[model samples]
Target: MKTNQFLFGLKNLDRGQTMKVAIFANDDMTSNIIFAQLFNMSDIQITGLYIAASPRKGTSSIIGGAISLLRRMAFGYWLFLVFTNGAFKVYEFLTLVFRCSPQTGTFYSLRRAAQLRGVRYRKVADFSSPEIAAELQNSNVDLLIIRVGDILQPKILDIPHYGTWCVHSSLLPSFKGIAGEFHALRTKRAPIGSTVFEVTPSLDEGTPLGQVAIQRDETGSVFQHMVNNNIAAGKLLASMVLQAFQCSAPSFELYTPQSQLKSSYHSWPKPDELKVLHRQRKALITPGEAMRLMLAAFRWG
Candidate 1:
């Protein structure tokens, strides 16, 4: 059986009938990678980008933040995230600084992507603000993609004619939270991949438009696996958007009650899970793998 079925038939759209798309994206490498893929698409017109800025930390000290993460994620998993995430940040920073080209395959900022593609980009503090809604209305955005952003309200979601969509890292209606890939790996889930789904008020419970299987290298570092997933997700989402536009009228197949009941949420890994990961001999990220990725990024640029 196929993993996903297109609910609408495909057809060609003329230049004048191009779909106007907007993105609610984050500043991180994952979001930027996804943006790069979408920016390269000539069929859809990218109208605007609403950058989801990181929330302020106020007066919280580094130690306080570390302690809070430790309480929830445990020391082992927390340290793993810090080290790997710090490495990713450094990688992203160097790519933006050195790369003069707007090519794909490297980590770059969303701002950089916008500047290269000549798309309108703005940092969004409050998504529910009337001003934001007005901007979307003025832009005549037909599709709104939530690559990275907070939970959206119905008012904003309803503005897009094709409705709001989200790209989840997992094949949802299953593994519905953060660390979705991690949990899928631990449980040996079959057909691990990404899903482009309709964004509803219920998180990760929306009807899926399509899914593409992404095979992971379990023997490799978690950091590398995550980066690979992000790249695959970007391509999958771009393909989804293209397919949606090709159809005369796009729609999705809702999940049955049994599938809805199977939706499970996973949080950050605990100490026990970390132990199991180690038992599998999967390092968070080896120094060699990090260097290789950086070199690849440089070459791609």
Candidate 2:
């Protein structure tokens, strides 16, 4: 609890401005990481956090922290929404360990995943509730951001002042839905990273707010690609949110999708296919001192 308090203090101070934010998040590490990083640079006043626990656990949970940051909002309120397929498993027998699978994720999982990366959560609410709409109406959110997860209802999507913005895992008009990075990997091609855009009634069909191309090496796994893309997406979203809070003109220019862009949706790989896919991705790692060095670099304290 003390750690959480300390982290929250740091988040508000980092941004150098205060924003009223509500967070809907689950998981642990990812949320903390990025929110923390953003707070380090700006001042954000987090209003509340609503986290729906992943389906693994069969119940929902909520977590909240204070947000103080770099920019000041004359009347800015923010919400970090989370959806998850609730699931929890014990890694060991008696240590109260838990594991969350992709299938068991809900909206909360999205928020949690981001928070685990060091972002602070302010508020939370489950998606199915009428209260969610009421909150959005009252929260005075200037903008809403959606990442990978359940599609928000029209009420929430349309409530924000500037409308909602979303981050698609795949390049727009290209790969959409699940398995975006996988498709790119299978095709032996590297594309731009994340596509940021304003939300419309249709998923992944929003107008492009911005698109950022990532630098990728010749040999890299779709997993790595996803990590790289997510980091970029997180930063992009943060920057936009910052600008919105300040009433500064949106940094995103109008982007219209172009032709010759192939788009497709992919389902998660099956067991047999997953095995093959894993092996293919691992093939890039190869056996070498470099692999060991990489492993040595990424460890938890």
lDDT of each: 0.67, 0.45
State the lDDT of candidate 2 residue by residue for 89-198, as single tens digits.
11111112233321121111333333443434433344535776677667765445544345567777766554666666666767776545555565545464667666
- Tell me the lDDT of model 1 at 12: 36
Each prediction's number of clashing residue pairs: 0, 89
Which segments of candidate 1 are over 4 A away from where they belong?
1-15, 55-71, 75-99, 189-191, 248-262, 293-301
lDDT of residue 287 for candidate 2? 46
Each model's TM-score? 0.79, 0.59
